[model samples]
Target: MTWKDKLGLVHIYTGNGKGKTTAAFGLAVRMLGSGGKVAIVQFMKAPKAYGEQKKIEECGALIESFGLPKFVHGKPTEEDIEAAKRALARAKELASSGEWDLVIVDEVCVALGFNMLDVGEVRELIKSKAPHTELVLTGRYCPEELFELADYVTEMREIKHPYQRGVIARRGVEY
Candidate 1:
């Protein structure tokens, strides 16, 4: 039997702090090392020069980003909505296809908070996942209803951050 035959659970990483994606990627690396298939659907983030992208690709995991290059602050534009919808659709397909052992929806909570995707749709996606396919959702502003549905929920609380001193995101560190 393959690793996919084992039990799979829903995991949510959410908070106002950093490391949600980092934690999820860490697990992805672990799962990949065990010869499991992983698919990451990144929402609100286009492909960039992040070091993790290269490493994840090299490790044989599929990673797809759906978003414009710019950051959305106030109101998301039509393009942002379209990209988020596409990302959700891709995530749903991956979760139920039985091709991947683990599916990560990166920054999906942020997409929901931005009103780019519906919470009910996300809930339905989670419910529709294959019984053996692990599902991971990462980002800030996770809805309370989702928390109730998750088997594991971790909140990364920021006690201190370099950004408070006007430090910008560093390559291979923050990205």
Candidate 2:
């Protein structure tokens, strides 16, 4: 369905790529340009030194980082799971009330892949979101259930990345 035709749409941007969260942010910008309210919940990223968080504030969107720096790769701690649950609950609250037109859960797939958040719970949250709200899920290895629930799915395959080389993540480009 067209974006206009879908009041509540689920989008999955998954795979081993660099632009999953970037794609979600692009959609948030699009929705914001259309005068849609947006809220972003970052699951895997810590609040320490994220450049997008600053840019999002400049763009007039609410962003909440609900992650600790304790998790490593696909392994998460018990505290990380708790944080994910609380963050997902907060996102659901915002989505259910219809205050925002778009809600983005960034790196949620990684959280699920690491068993930090329940896939069933996330699916239910998306299914139960307000009709006027759109939800975007972004991260690598999105769950099959989430993929099935999505109205649109875009996978970004990494042919090559600068990280493969000795190139460090520079400011504004990598962060």
Candidate 3:
């Protein structure tokens, strides 16, 4: 069914702290509760690598994840670049298809942070989304340039964190 809202707005969740993806997933569930269609294209994360992957899929949201098994610290490898390109292409299709009420580009800012994807391409992806599609972009290092295109921009600043105390990312908590 087509969305009946007045408009679909762009949302950005970015900062150093956690919960960006969590917030996006929260909104996904909220939209699904009302029988809205959702699609999530994950960048820089491999398939079935995160806890939410299976659960979110079980909740009936379409999930597409792409990334190399290893993390990129400095210059990204050719595989990393290619994977992100594919993810962006799929995200572009979903965002502009008008078949989904919400389309999320998860960890996109991290891909941008690593230079795996171009900011200009991302800007165009946002602009090309269907007028009735609600878009949510999640991850850290979100460029200031994107804020102007969004209707809602929330930053999850890190005042304190378990990582500072030498804690590792716990499954189901950080992943």
**Candidate lDDT values, in order:** 0.92, 0.84, 0.92
Question: Which residue segments of model 1 deviate by more than 4 Å?
Answer: 1-3
Evaluation by lDDT, superior candidate among 2 and 3: 3
What RMSD, rounded to one decimal, does every model reach?
1.1, 2.4, 1.5
In the predicted model 1, the residue pairs found to clash are: none
User: Which segments of model 3 are wrong by more than 4 Å?
Assistant: 1-3
What lDDT tens digits, residue by residue, belong to model 2 across residues 41-111?
88877775688887886898999988886545556777888889888998889888888889998888888
lDDT of 1 by residue, 48-126 (tens): 6478987898898999999789889899999899999999999999999988889999999999999898899999989
Query: Could you tell which candidate, 1 or 2, scores higher by TM-score?
Result: 1
Lowest summed lDDT across 10 adjacent residues in model 2 is found at 69-78
Any residue pairs clashing in model 3, and if so which? none
lDDT of 3 at 120: 99
Residue 141 lDDT (model 3): 94
lDDT of 3: 0.92
Report the alpha-carbon TM-score of model 2 versus the true structure.
0.91
**TM-scores across all candidates?**
0.96, 0.91, 0.96
